[model samples]
Target: MLAGIRQALPEAVCLVVDDNSPDGTAEMAREFARENGCEQNVWVKVREDERGLGGAIRAAMQVAIDNGFDLFCNLDADLSHDPVDLPRLVETCLSENADVVVGSRYVSGGAIVGWPWRRRVMSGMINGFTRTLLRLPVRDASGSYRCYRVERLAGLDPPRNPSDGYAFIQEVLMRLHREGARCVEVPITFTERRHGTSKLDLPEAVRSGLTVFRLLATR
Candidate 1:
């Protein structure tokens, strides 16, 4: 993924935020940066404490804001999201004047690969339920592969967002929608992770479901 991003966007800085993985992911990132001679542009932020996926992303956004970046894209490190599609997301945001651009699997031309039927069904059901319940115009509400305009995202004060897991994706979209942010969805193929275990589980699913209700109640 790091190689792909560097190849695709040579000018863009890459930030790898790790939750102090036992596998030495942070050290690996530093080694890669040095080996590639991208130490000037690439950075590794190691979180000594536990912070969920959402928190990690939120921290990255804060970094982007602090460093004066105009836009930022987030993708999974497990290779599920294709780095080649980064340009499309950014281009769509620019061409369509969108505040957020989601790399969607539920849209036309989008697809999921290497997943069993059961997993596919569950993902589809969750996306469908969340979209209907939240009244969101997007087809894939839970997808985290997305590009955000920093000015618009900064307006939301992302650090203070309540969600700490996958639910953060839904909460940000809902909040952006309410704030009249323009959003666009670009089709992309989502592949299953080739390494490590998926973080999703029954408990996380239930928590995400309850998060939807909490969001609705607050509204």
Candidate 2:
């Protein structure tokens, strides 16, 4: 994943945030950086605390913001997200002056491969539920593959989101919508992971559902 990203976006400052993965993901990324003479552009941040998707993403984004970066992009390191498509997303953000550019699977030209029907149905339901209930204007608020304007992300700096899991994706999008962010969605294909177990289980999905209600009630 690190090599692919470097090859696709040589100018990008890649920040890899790992929650102390037992597989030595952080060390491998560091080694990759050193070997490629990209020590200045590739950075690895290892979290010693409890693992949380939102926390990891927030920390990484904050680092970019504090370092005076104008743009920040994040995608799954599992190769589910295509690094080659990154340029299109970034270009859309600039062309549209969007606060965030989402790589959406529900939009035109978007497709999902290798997922079972049950998983697809559940995903669609959750996306539709969050979009309607949270009043998000975008079709795919749950997508983590996105490019965000550092300035817009900065406004949420002490991180207003309460979710630490997948719910954080939708909640943050909802919050940004409330803040009047101009969001744009670009088509992207989502391919299920061919290796490794998925962290999202039945319990996690239920929790995310409950969190949606919590957000609605709090609103």
Candidate 3:
């Protein structure tokens, strides 16, 4: 994934946030940086503590903001998100002057590959439920593959946003919508992970559902 991104956007800086994986992911990222002569552009930050996916993403955003990056893209590292689609997301943000661009699986021309019927059905149902409840303009509220304009995100004070876990993605969009951030959705094919077990289990799904209610109640 790192290699693909580097090849696709050589000028973009890559930040790998490792949550102290026993598999030596951080070391591998550092090695990749050295081998590609991107040590100046690619950086790996290893978190000794176990922060969930949402936390890690927030940390990365903070780092990017601190380093003065104007835009940043976030995607799953499990190889499910195709690096080839990244340019399209970035392009949409720039071309449309959108504050946020989501790679939507439920949008027209978007499809999911390598998933069984049951999983696909469940995903569709969840997306529909969330969309109806939140009344969001987006079709895929749970998708994490997204690009954001740093200036717009900064106005929302991302560091102070309280959402964690998968709910964070929805929270971000909801907050951005309230702040009148321009959002665009780009169709993309989502593939099942080829490596590492998925962290999204029944418990996480329940939590995500509850998060929707929480957001609504608070609003």
Poorly placed runs, candidate 1 (over 4 Å): 158-161
Query: Mind giving the per-residue lDDT tens digits that candidate 3 earns over 1-219?
Result: 899898777889989999998999999999999897889888899987767787788788888888889898999998899999988999999999999999999889998999988778777776888788877779988789999998877777543447668777787788888788888999999999998876666787788889889887766
| lDDT (Cα, tens digit) per residue for candidate 1, span 178-210 | 889998999999999999876666678888889
lDDT of 2 by residue, 1-219 (tens): 888888888899999999988998999999999898999999999999758887788778889889999999999888889898999999999999999999999999998999988888888888899899998989997789999999888886354547888888887788788889999999999889878876567887898899999999866
**Ranking according to lDDT, highest score first:** 1, 2, 3
| lDDT of model 1, residue 13 | 90
Pairs of residues clashing in candidate 1: none
In angstroms, the error of model 1 at 202 is 1.1
Report the Cα lDDT for candidate 1.
Answer: 0.88
Clashes of 1: 0
Which ten contiguous residues of candidate 1 have the minimum total lDDT?
157-166
Local distance difference test scores for all models? 0.88, 0.88, 0.85
Give candidate 3's TM-score.
0.95
Off by over 4 Å in 3: 158-161
